[model samples]
Target chain A: MKFTILINEGPYQHQAADSAYQFAKAALEKGHEIFRVFFYNDAVNNATRLAIPPQDDRNITVQWAELAEQNNLDMVVCIAAAQRRGMLDDDERDRQGKDASNIHPAFRISGLGQLVEGGIQSDRLITFGD
Target chain B: MAMLHIVNKSVFERGTLDSCLKSSLSGSSILFIEDAVVSAVNNTAVSDKIKAELSSKNFYVLTPDLNARGFTDADLIEGIKGVDYAGFVDLVADNSNVQSWL
Candidate 1:
């Protein structure tokens, strides 16, 4: 089955991101297709490359990036939510005339329509949030 | 292709319930869990809206959540059904998709 996972909380602050990561990994391992992992609300923080966690703790952002790289996963961060939280890609940074862009290369910033589209296109739309 | 919309926040505490109700499709089913069970009670400020929505939507409150919050089936608003965890799972299986409104 094709599944779309929606994460609505930032990493570390909530267990939603971890639960979503585990579910996505298990789905892929079970041979199920993950259509997309749409990040919204505080979840856009997951795509920011600026976070630096201690050596002892798991870095969820890096984990997501590696998972996306290995599986060719579509990791999308909602542009509106990203903008609200100051998460920006190169294009957005240039458009907004910002000095830097913190978004990781593995994740792309897109509109909320992608989330609606994912809901329509995928077999299951599983949301993990606060 | 109906959707099962799960709300886990209280209506009085947050706009989550309102947003879920506003965004829901006509035939969608709404299951109130956790703190959202507070909205399923009778004679609340949002009871009128819930009753009105019942004309085109199916409303359910998680029985466990309701009980945990000290509410009974009799306290539920008219047309709202109390469902168990199995019923919640069944609702998810029955719907084409599940949207959790946080």
Candidate 2:
């Protein structure tokens, strides 16, 4: 089966990010194809590389990056939401005249069009949010 | 087509479960995850309502979320089933589409 994931909340503060990650990993382990993982609303925070979780706790951001790298997943952060929350990739940072880019390399900032495309292209679009 | 309706909020905290139950059609699958697992317990305020709907729609709760909340499968309502992350994936794959009640 082909699936798309939609995450709407940030890491640590909510369980949505962790649950989405677990679901995505389980799906991939089951031999299902993940079309894309779309980060919307506060979920764009998951792509920020600056978050440093406690040593005893799970680093949700790194978990996502590693999962995406292992599965060759398309992790897209919504450009509008990313802009609202000040999440920036190198290109977006340059475009917005920002001094630094915080977005993790595993995630690329894109538009809602990619989300719609994922919904259309996949068999299921599962959302994990608050 | 049978849709998979996922609820991630607690019924005690939000009306998401109520709205999902009301809007979901018969034959659909309802999977409670995260805080929503609290609703799957046998003797809550909303238990009767959920029990009544059991015959109409399938009900499931995520096991890890329940365990995180210090709940066990024995705490689940008679008709509701508990599933792990792999089962969660199967639910999505088996259903026609997913409607997450946030």
Candidate 3:
């Protein structure tokens, strides 16, 4: 099946994001293609390239990056959400004259269009949060 | 089929998720919304159960509602996930079916 996942949480905070990860793994293992993974709202913060977690912490940013890299996944973040949470790519930061850019390379900053495209192109679109 | 699960109630609320999850699903999509997104918090039993079920099917969680309620993606542990409004619209469009929980 062609799968599109809408991840709504971060990797450390709770199970939502992580659950999406597990399900992604399952989909891939079952030979399902992951169309795209869209992050919105507070979940958009997961794209921060500068997230600093303690050594004992889960380090969600790195984890998500690694997973996306391994699977060649399309990790998307909502442009609106990222701006509200102070997460921005280099272009966005430069455009807005922000102090820095925090969105990692593994994730792309885009609008809800990607989400719409993913849902339309994929056979199944699964959301993992409220 | 396109289905949305709303996690509206807080994770701690009594029977909030249980009722939603166990509701009739003859052929409906479920998305979690509201405070229930809190259940995605790490080590939460609710997230565990929900994750397990989602692994076998095509259910998903929403993210904007959580953000509006002040919940961050970092608060989630393993199962819950995020989706945008466009994704929601696509789901409704892709599938000729629809239903809502609360």
Query: Candidate 1 lDDT, tens digit per residue, A14-92?
Result: 7678767876876777677889999999999999888999999999999999999999999999999999889999999
Worst-scoring 10-residue span by lDDT in model 3 chain B: B93-102
Superior by TM-score: candidate 1 or candidate 3: 3
Candidates 2 and 3 compared by TM-score, better number: 2
lDDT of model 2 at position B27: 97
Scored against the true structure, residue B1 in model 3 reaches a CA lDDT of: 54
Clashes of 3: 56
Alpha-carbon DockQ of candidate 2: 0.94
**What C-alpha RMSD does candidate 3 show over the true interface residues after superposing them?**
9.1
Worst 10 residues of 1 chain A by lDDT: A22-31
lDDT for position A94 in model 1: 99
Candidate 2 lDDT over residue span A61-118, tens digit each? 8999999999899999999999988999999889889999999999999999999999
Question: Which stretches in model 1 have alpha-carbon errors above 4 Å?
Answer: B1-96, B99-101
Instruction: Order the candidates by DockQ, highest first.
Output: 2, 1, 3
Docking class of 3: incorrect
RMSD of each: 6.6, 0.9, 10.2
Each model: TM-score of chain B?
A: 0.97, 0.98, 0.66
Give the docking tier of candidate 2: high
For candidate 3, lDDT tens digit of each residue in A1-130?
Answer: 6877787766566566765675676566656688899997678977877767898877777887888898899999999888888989999999999888888999999999999998789877767653
